[model samples]
Target: MLREYYKFLGNRLIDWSQTIAIQAGDRYVLNFENDDQVRQFMSVLSEFNGIHNFYLMTERSGPNALAFDIDPDSHMQLVVVSTVEVTPDYLVNLRNRIGQQQGVWENTALLFVSNKVLDSINSGAKDIGRQGGPFNTGALKRNVQATVDKSEKLSKDDKDVLKFMVKTIYDGEQELTLMDFADVYGIIEKGELSDSDYIQMGYFQDQDLATYSSKEERLAENHADYVNISLAHGFGDVRSRITKIVDGEKLISDLSGNNWQSVNYKQILAGKERLKQNKKISLVYDAEIMQGINEDMLIWDHPKGTSKAGQRTRYIIVFNDKHQNKLTVKFPFDATVQDKWITQSKINHKHYTVGTHKNQLVVDFSDLKTNEPESVKVRYRHHDIGSLGFTFNILILPFTDNKILGLRPYYRVKVKGEKKANLEIPSDMDELILGSGIQSNKLNVDKTSQLDNLMLGPNDQLKADLSQLSLDDDNESFTVTLGSVPLNFNVFDNDDNKIQPRVL
Candidate 1:
């Protein structure tokens, strides 16, 4: 019976076609067919000289077994061995169980398997084995593809990390650390690096440099156009000098003027006609394509960065067809007496009155003249903005001479605490038509536009606009709906390690 058991164990190691005669004091055999059998064999082996040294073996036929030397490194006169057929699930479970008490058997990489197993694995194919011995490309591809595909369902930062991972894997990289992987796969060309790669690299270090580089590359691609416009804040109240210039009226006295009457009437008529021009401005922001912030994050604030104060600046840059003499501007929120305004000379004219209708700032430029550049600057304190960041939305309520040439919003932001504020400019700034700006700005301070401080204050702003201008809208004030971008975050640490925050 002992010899029969020995043969059974040997058969697990060798093919059933092969035979071996059991010799006394030479090879001892044990049966391990299931979890109970494995435990029983371990118990018996532990009793005799201890199962100190063992080598694991695998087979394609679904049998896994172990061979042991009671006294390894010594000339052992007795060898203990066992084998059993196991399904894929069983082998996985067995490995996990062994790992649980692997103190003595850890770091053992030596594995021996039957020629049939090797042949079956290859089916006589030599490419995968030759390129990298025993690598399962199919398994690798599926594992990697699954990870990347799943990441698409996550926030933008995760997709960036996965993009870097996918790019590395596609290059047959052994690791995600670019430095280490570069040694094996060779350095990547600057031109070949994707936007995602730069973003992922930024999280690990030199984020400003990464951001600048990504922006440069994007510009080079010519996939879209970009613009930057700087809007400043004024310290005093809205200019109150009041006057209404009607048809053929003049603000400047023309004592030496020649035929000023006809010129004044033409200007007024032309301005009215320009305001009547038809304009088309659709929201250029695509919530599906644009990346957003992730909610959960572990912040490593810059030494000079501060915590938790938030404020938003909305920019409205309008260009009419050099026609109208005055354009009325309205604020969605009430401008407290404390709020300051820095705008164009005409829009800030003494005639402009900052009134409260429905508790919001309403500026009427009745005496305003046509085709002068203008913007609104409202500086106020804000709170309750979560870590993900804030959003600025523009909804066009139909109004007259409402031809929106092009909108290039330069976002100005002030975080809770910090010495100097930062600016977040989008690479793509197109114009928005009725009720919508062509582009939506997502001011997430974690990935593409992170600042030194945890919260933003007055100085953080968007300072650029697209060059193209001119969309015509004949509708009255308050006719359109505005849309914002998707929201969430994906972040990482300095060692190029992906950071996944724990949710409470």
Candidate 2:
């Protein structure tokens, strides 16, 4: 028998294992094989040495047992000495739940375990030691990038912060205060240096810089291409008036006198073709790999026409920025709208949700039934859109590796509480596509062109043109089936640190 925080045995103790966790202040029963060590512990605790709340537990289901609750946050520390030989019944728990205060942290925790317990844990190859935070590669990388990006020009404080970040990346334990960094950069003084002197300057403003981390989320929404065309004539008043007055069919003959006829027609035709091609191509966005978003996702249907000839299509999603990781179809929910349009899924399937919300770009494959269908039902709920006048628009384009790199995403964001433009930040990884490092496929581009010409919707101009000539004597209604699902995304409340990412 020996004094230990965890109990020895009972009908319930058989489930105890060496790696199991035990919370403090839990009542446990300690069954004794011998009584001497128990008496010694009692004598040591009985000295009235301010052990205020000790209860002698005797409600054992068997003959010999001892049990009690150890008060948590107890100012006094209790040392449990073991005296029993190793037996199958004898067990020790490794995961002791200790209280930790937020923001403030304690290091140098002491864990005492019997050699037998260590041996058991080693046999299972389970190490009880693991740490979190500041060590996640992507998190740390984004944090570092944010810190570095904030300073277009570095202040002494910024430089010091940079040095601290490098040190922490390679080393295990590193701690530095603002003063320590300031001193290293020679911003410290011994003479009449006053804190209020540079209080409004860069150093003072960057005090909370260490805590500033970019929301490294892939944007949830897909990107739409924006095109603006301008037509102007700079000829004499008579020529300009004539150019403006040119009628549609007569305009060609009217402008033929000038050299602008063929060139303008070519440009107009090109623009029209480009516009048509742009509409057929589309992008779907997802998040980074191994960031705890979606675990495994696949392109269920390659963008292709149902025709026997498998015409492929090329497409791309432009990100707000470029990134290193693979753009996984699986992305975290809240991160789906972080202004990053980098990660995207190509939409070749007939029925799919493709578009961006305020912070989310969603491509839903849930309601898809067959591969033959063409037009998809798009639905959404946007955030803070009315006041700021944010409307959902889409841009479809041919996918290529170059498109991923050229992705420059922007949004018209208006702030709350003020009737002016609000804070603007660069798109996140999901804001745009990085490199389409995936093997190039010409299929995506070809398929887009082929489908755009297919005339997908019922009664749509395109559909009407492509509709087969009906020869039936009786009128039969043509029915088109559309798939839809409720698209719901909870607004990410920054005030609450509880961030939940959903994988679709």
Candidate 3:
């Protein structure tokens, strides 16, 4: 029988979160590392829509294969890569060959859980605690508390100084953030307190500070300033995370090992994120470069109709093979050659202006000078604001010559002049939810020991035996294990099954 839930990792139905959509002419592809993994891939074959064809490949075909993920139509046939840590050199060469050939297939990409065929990917970061990096509950608790103790303790005077210092920075949007507060505390601890102390409402009571504002204005301003900085850093964003600490326990996630925390909160606005990218240009490629991208990458601007994220420069690198190698190619490319690149996003809710910061993207020519290139054309993807992957409506630029070209995206964060995010780091980061970064109230979990298992019937009231459970830091929580009990046939099912077997 098929189980209602499968628990390999993240979710049994990992693909359920997204729809399996294929356009009328789209072709889909599935690739694997080995025979076992290939079988695993086939096990979930029932998940996709309109899967008409499947095949296995051992050699190279054409150019666009490397540039894009060998997708034919909007659909694809699975391509398997049984290799590990295929270097940028390999990826680049593959791209150059496939990229040189234009319009052979629709679009395509290589898919693998990890370079190892496991979820580890091709790097140093370990996912499961069994492999590397501590992921167990004990490790997590120590890390959390340590990060907290390492944080700065603010003094009354330090708080006032930091608040004033930050107000000068995000003056347009309000700065006086916790970071500014931390900075002041650091300075004070370092014994550099030539500046006056920050006493919250107490600092401005003196005649010297009063010259800046009246008592009424000072109080109102301080409250407003405090409210502003607290909201942006993901403070009490979720109600479930907020609770009264009576003996330090939360209403949820209190089953076993646990920790609870709160973050700084401030006023907020509702909106989505957008990416700043290079301009669209009418150009052509070797038609092989499309292999790297299977999904159509759409460039998006903000809904507010302005982007402050990218202006700095970074190269729109095109690899010649599976490993990244700059391709030597010439074509009418429509990418921006600006020197600026996106570093980080803005903190304020207001729309960021373009050209306020410098960011850049440029392709290196040295790699292209090599004999092998990944593909003929280069491809890039970014942001939900502009383009959708697979739309393919934009003009395709061709790459026939060999020379590295640089493309740049605009960024909102200022470098060498202003700072970002220092103020927004949460005071209680340990409580953040994985993936969503949502803060949750700390839960305590312990092994249930009672053998008198009792399955609570619908509308059943739960009475606790404090003797069987261990006392937790959170007084509200107690752990108990219950056993199944014999049910009398006289009991009725919710379905009103009287004569039916009650064992079910």
lDDT of 3: 0.26
TM-score of each: 0.17, 0.14, 0.17
TM-score of 2: 0.14
Each prediction's Cα RMSD? 29.0, 30.8, 41.8
Task: Write the residue-wise lDDT of candidate 1 on 1-504 in tens digits.
Answer: 222222323332233112233222222122222444444433444433323434333333333344443233342222232223334454344345333434433432212221123222223223221223222333334344454444323444434444554544455534332122221111121213333333232211122323442433422221111000000012121111101121111311220133222222223333333323312111111122111121111111111112222223232322333334554544443223222322222122334445534423445444433322222233322121111121222111122222222222222222211111222222233312222233334332212323112221222222222223222233111111111211111111113222233355
Order of quality (lDDT): 1, 2, 3
lDDT of 2 by residue, 1-504 (tens): 112211211111222322244333222222222445345444444333233332111232222212222233432222222323334223232212112311111211112222233342233322221122212233333344344444344554444544443343334435432112222122111111123322211111122234545311100000000011112234344333433333233442344344332223223333344435544533232233212333232211121122322111211122212221223232223323433332222223433445444445454433322222122212222221111111222212112224223222222121222111121212121221222334322212111122222212222211111122222223211222211211111111123222233256
Q: Pairing residues by index, what is the TM-score of model 3? A: 0.17
Error of 1 at 321 (Å): 5.4
lDDT of 3 by residue, 1-504 (tens): 011111121121123212243222222222233455433433433333433232222333322121212234444432223233344555444334233432433333332322233322323222332222222323332333333234365444434444454344334533232122233333333433332233322222232433443334544554453344333224543322221111112222221112211211111110100111213322122123333232222221111112221211111223232322222222111333232322233222122222211111222223322222111112233321123111111111112111111011111111111211110111111111111112222332232223123343222333322223332232321111111112110101112211222253
Instruction: Mark the 10 consecutive residues where model 3 has the least summed lDDT.
Output: 264-273
lDDT of 3 at 202: 20
Point out where model 1 deviates above 4 Å.
1-311, 318-324, 333-348, 380-504
